[model samples]
Target: MADLALQFGGDLAIGPTGDLLLSEGTTLTQQRVLRRLLTNPLDYIWQLNYGAGLGKYVGQPGAPAAIAGMARTQILLEAAVVASPAPIVGVMAQTDGTVNLSLSYTDAAAGETSALTFSL
Candidate 1:
């Protein structure tokens, strides 16, 4: 059996003409970890391990709050993708009343490093 290919947006490749777009190799792996982190678990019937539901972590943006949320976020990501190293998570409070989630992790299998930033 071959591994399935999926887009970061969770769209399996379907050509415009309704044909399956078969992605391969590095193209299939790029951003895969990040996408998994962005996905919320149980959002889909077929994929129960899809995401960490990071949106739920949105909360008051203070040093203590950020640290606590960051810890939870790291645990969620770790559970979601065991092959990836425990993520380095950082939080920044914004003047606009938003919190920034900054994350970086290395894929254990590919040795690829990824960085992502999200505002909540």
Candidate 2:
């Protein structure tokens, strides 16, 4: 959610006349989007969280021991996904149930493109 978090913040826009704006619907340039994508600091944290032990919480508690926690996490994670407003910017997941990952975007440059893919 890090890059997605920032990308949500990246909310760059171009004014009808031309200028840089932010998520508030100002105006911005193509360069600003790229800048956000390249420099946003969250990429590091995003990678770690997505690639590591995200499974512990999957089990969570006594909702039901029989209920597969990993499966549950995957389901909720996926749901938080489609329900998200911003286009997904990036993702990382481990093959084992040990890790799962997702990204949600809040801000998106007009014409900007994004996709979400998962493995595990």
Top lDDT prediction, candidate number:
1
Instruction: Name the lDDT of candidate 1.
Output: 0.55
Q: Which candidate ranks first by TM-score, i.e. highest? A: 1
Q: What is the TM-score of each candidate against the true structure?
A: 0.50, 0.20
- The CA lDDT of each predicted structure is 0.55, 0.32
Relative to the unseen true structure, what is the C-alpha lDDT of residue 9 in candidate 1, on a scale of 0 to 100? 60
**TM-score of decoy 2:** 0.20
Off by over 4 Å in 1: 1-30, 60-85
Q: In candidate 2, what residue range of length 10 has the lowest lDDT sum?
A: 1-10
lDDT of 2 at 18: 73
Collision pairs in model 2: 8-107, 13-27, 13-28, 14-28, 15-27, 20-27, 20-28, 21-27, 21-28
Q: List the residue pairs that clash in candidate 1.
A: 39-51
Q: Candidate 1 on 1-120: residue-level lDDT in tens? A: 224567566676776678776654334443454465456678857878656665565564455364545444644444223344566677776676666766665544446665666665
Residues forming the 10-long window of minimal summed lDDT in candidate 1: 75-84
Error of 2 at 42 (Å): 16
